[model samples]
Target: MYVVIFRARIRQLDEDYRRSAERLRELALGRYGCLAFHALSEGEEEIALSYWPDEAAIRAWNNDPEHRQAQQLGRERWYAWHRVEVAQIERAYGAAP
Candidate 1:
């Protein structure tokens, strides 16, 4: 499995940002083989995590046109700073909810 982690310091997030964020999540899951996604925000910082089957799936999502546009918007409007990391998962464990 692969994981993409995004940490950002927010600048502004309006309705357009919200809509596009949701759309991007849907696209990632429905078309890009994204296994799961989670996000949290506190104060002006946000962290988003997305899991994928492999690096190729992650790469495909990263290069998606809509995603590219969103990234550009984030850099120009919604975020003051951001960092992204991709990692391969060796193992994972969790208890049932």
Candidate 2:
């Protein structure tokens, strides 16, 4: 498994931002082999996590044109700063007591 983490410092989140986010998440889940996705926003900070089965899936998702456009928007309007990290998920554990 692989995880792509995007940490961003948001400048402003407009209505358009929320709409864009929903559409992107829908596109990712509907078309790509996106195992899971989550977005967290707190004041000016935001982090989004996307999980995939492998690097190939991640690459395909990264190359998506709509996603590219969103990236540009984020840099130009939405985010003051950002960092992206791709990590190999070594293990996952869960339990129910």
Candidate 3:
């Protein structure tokens, strides 16, 4: 498994941003082979973590037209700064309570 970490300094968020975010999450999970998606925000900062099966899926998702539009909108309106990092999972260990 691989993980994409997205960190952003938020500029502003409106209804469009909310709707777009929901749609993109659905699109990523349903069409792009996203294994899981999680996100949170605090103050003016946001972080999202999405798990993927491979680099190809990630590349495909990145190139999707709607996603591209969202990226542009993010750059123009929603985010002040953002960074994305992709990393491979080496091992897994977890506990459930």
Candidate 4:
């Protein structure tokens, strides 16, 4: 399994930004092979995490045209700074409460 993490310092942190972010997340979470998605914001910081079955899905999601456009918009209009991290999940253990 693969996990992707995104950390951002938001510039224009407003309703419009939230709308676009949610739309982009929906697209990603709806894509084939996506296991799950999560996002949050606090103060000027925003974070998102997504899980995928393998590297190919992550690569394809990264190269998606709409995702590319969203990333460009993040740099140009929404985010003052951003960081991304990808890692393999060797094992995960949990259960529903």
Lowest lDDT 10-mer window, candidate 3? 88-97
Best by TM-score: 3
Output the better candidate (2/3) by lDDT.
3
Clashes of each: 0, 0, 0, 0
> What overall lDDT, based on C-alpha atoms, would model 4 receive against the true structure?
0.86
Please list the C-alpha lDDT of all candidates, in the order they appear. Answer: 0.95, 0.91, 0.98, 0.86
lDDT string, candidate 4, 2-96, tens digits:
99999999888667667877777777778756789888889999998999999999999889887888888889999999999999999788894
Ranked candidates, highest lDDT first: 3, 1, 2, 4
Q: CA shift at 72, candidate 1, in angstroms?
A: 0.4
In model 3, residue pairs whose N, Cα or C atoms come closer than 3 Å (at least 3 residues apart or on different chains), thus clashing, are none
Put down candidate 3 lDDT per residue, 1-97, tens digits, no spaces: 9999999999999999999999999999999999999999999999999999999999999999999999999999999999999999999887942
**lDDT, candidate 1, 8-69, per-residue tens:** 99999999999999999999999999999999999999999999998889889999999999
Scored against the true structure, residue 86 in model 2 reaches a CA lDDT of 98
TM-score of each: 0.96, 0.94, 0.97, 0.88
